[model samples]
Target: MPTERRIGPARERDRLADAREDERAHAVIRNVRAARMVAGRADSAEECSLLLEMLGLEPAAERR
Candidate 1:
């Protein structure tokens, strides 16, 4: 005979929390990429600066 393992409510809740965090991280990445694309196509430095500021991201020069 063999015993089976089961997930408790606590473990389930932890798993859900981890999944939500992963989703939030992925959303942040997507938003950053989208902002980069828009910034790349911006007509002027001022526009790019404003877009980066609104997205709460640093400029490319400062990232390195």
Candidate 2:
């Protein structure tokens, strides 16, 4: 005989919430890094612009 696994409503909600939180956290990190690059954290505006272009995002003429 095969056994069936079940998830209660509360547990299901918790799992969904955790997944969403993970996605949000990742987005926050990416946005912060992008902002830093745009603000000239590591390299010049031209270099960052080139990087952004390569990633298919618009190149900014100057740092943010």
Candidate 3:
């Protein structure tokens, strides 16, 4: 039981680290780091669009 409890927090910490790294990667590409943060949450292109619309923000300007 003790071992099981340790594993849960370890896994959660790892997941949070991965999420932070993902946003850091995005920060390098876009002005608003938050964009990368939100993009990480979206499961699909459609979902991303919906999120953007709701936030009243435009899609990333046509990637070169």
* Top of the candidates by lDDT: 1
- For model 3, how does the per-residue alpha-carbon lDDT over 2-59 read when each residue is reduced to its tens digit? 5554558889999999999999888656645556667889999899888877766667
TM-score of each: 0.63, 0.56, 0.44
Q: Give the distance in Å from residue 35's predicted Cα in candidate 2 to where it truly belongs.
A: 0.3
Over 4 Å off in model 1, which ranges?
45-64
Worst 10 residues of 2 by lDDT: 54-63
Instruction: Give one digit per residue, the lDDT tens place, for model 2 in 1-64.
Output: 7598789999999999999999999977786677566657537767776767665556434558
Q: Give model 2's TM-score versus the native structure.
A: 0.56
Tens-place lDDT per residue, model 1, 1-64, is: 6588889999999999999999999988887797789787999989988888887776765565
What Cα-based lDDT does every candidate model obtain? 0.85, 0.73, 0.76
Rank by lDDT, highest first.
1, 3, 2
lDDT of 2: 0.73
Please report the TM-score between candidate 1 and the true structure: 0.63
Error in Å for residue 57 of model 1: 11
